[model samples]
Target: MSNRVLKILVPIISIILGLFVGAIVMWMSGYDAINGYIALWHGIFGSSYSIGETIRQISPYILAGLAVAFAFRTGLFNIGVEGQLIVGWFAAAYVGMAFELPAFIHLPLALLAAAAAGALWGLIPGILKATLRVHEVIVTIMMNYIALHTVNALITTVSDGSYKIDRIQKTASLRSEFLSNLTDFSTLHYGILIALLMVVVMWFILEKTRTGYELKAVGFNDHASQYAGMNVNKNIVLSMVISGAFAGLGGAMEALGTFGNISKMGGFTGIGFDGIAVALLGANTPLGVIFGATLFGSLKYGANNMPNAAGVPVEIVSIVIALIIFFVASGYIIRVLLNRMNKKKEAK
Candidate 1:
């Protein structure tokens, strides 16, 4: 198979294989795979409410996926999306609840605050990597803990020793009566538009701009780019900042659109980490991320219904997702098979 066709084929086959493996696991575990999947499907898409919830879940995944993909494109591993996201969430929430202005002003300001906070968090690792030859993986991972603890402290302080911050002001909310009514009063919000728009923007910048060329070149070979007059270190720093901004935007969506408050967490909010799988499954492209996010969101939303309706464990759904990720990450196997087929056809 050609590379183009192989790209499409691998993911489709991986998804099928993942589901097949999930079913096998379910059978071994004494669960009804068919019933589980049926319930899962209904839970994710059977009703207007479910559809809206799926959409809402997907909005953040899109941005988070973009974050990872952008970093990967620039030859960087951004393991600290969680940290940047947390800071962004707090920053957006801070702006949202602290300000009282028209929606047009407050909403954008809050979102920008999130992006800025995320960018700053990301920049720290970038500067370290660029200047001191420090590995971003370590810095970013450490930063994640720092961000979590710092945000928790700040939120608690703001809430006067409470675990959660207050609800955002009305003017800063992304929720809309029209959207709620359209989706049968689901928690979906206008943040979906922003997410979709970001996808478009990512595509445009990465595929149609000189800056993208520079970034990609640096990713391909930083030394070569540097030799060719590109600012390799600058590109590295810029890529991380951009990636962090994407993650922060996702946090802002969750804060303003979905939750409407910042709550204490005992552990990392797994959304940013999930973006790694999303980027891998998406082939690190904007359009591909949309498809990957849909699958992920469906599985996530559907998993909640499995135990209740199918008499199956919710962990089964996670197993299926993990299987899918495993297969996608093992795509070299698929390509080898495709190459063998191509050789056979040539021999014929």
Candidate 2:
């Protein structure tokens, strides 16, 4: 088979294998695996409310996934997306609360603040990596801690000992007028639209822009790119800045649309970490990230209902997601199995 064919087949086979393995594990643990899966499906797609919830949950995943995917295209591992996201969250929230402008100006301004904050956060690691020869992975990890503590401290100061910030102004908040009937007045907002728009924008940027070509070239081979007259260091830094902006936007969506305010001691949420898996599963592409985020969001939303109905732990969702990533990452095993089966058929 051609390499392209193998690439296509491997992930499908790996998913099947992962599901089978997950079923076996669930069965051995004394759970009715079939019922568990049914419950999960029901929770994710059974009703309009469930579907809306799934979309809401995955909205941030899309942006976070895009952030990681963008960085991957530049051959950079962005572990600090969590930190960048936090900073963006706070920056957007603070701006939303501090301002009193019309929605047209207020909303866009808040989002822009988020992007800028995230971009600045990402620039730190990019500069460190480009000029100081520091590894991006290490720098990003450290930046996560700094962002968390810094946000936490800022939140406490703003809240005057309270944990949560005051409700965001109406103009800056994201509301869902279209899905009010489906959500039963749930907090699910219009941020999903923003995320979807970003998916398209990212696709255009990566597929149609010259800067994207430079970024891709650097990712393919930095030494070769430099030899070919590309500004490798600048591209590296620019990639991080763009990636950080995406992550920041993700955070802003969550803050303005979902939470409505920032919280002190705002912990490092796993959304950013989960983005790594999402990007990998999607092969670091815009459309792939959307599909991957949807799958993950469905799993997360469904898992929340499982603990109540199936007497199973919601944490199992994480395990399943991890298994999926593991299988995909080692997809050569699936290719080998397929090759063996084809050879057996020929022999027969």
On TM-score, the leading prediction is: 1
Point out where model 1 deviates above 4 Å. none
Using all chains and alpha carbons, the TM-scores for the candidates as numbered come to 0.98, 0.95
Residue pairs with clashing backbones, model 1 = none
For model 1, residues 105-216, the per-residue Cα lDDT tens digits are 9999999999999999999999999999899999999999999999999989999999999999999999988878888999999998998898998888888999999999
- Model 2 CA deviation exceeding 4 Å by range: 2-5, 339-348
lDDT of 2: 0.88
lDDT (Cα, tens digit) per residue for candidate 2, span 116-186: 99999999999998898799999999999999999888888888888878878989998766675667665
In terms of lDDT, the best-performing candidate is 1
Q: What is the model-wide C-alpha lDDT for candidate 1?
A: 0.92
Residue pairs clashing in model 2 are none
Error of 1 at 93 (Å): 0.8
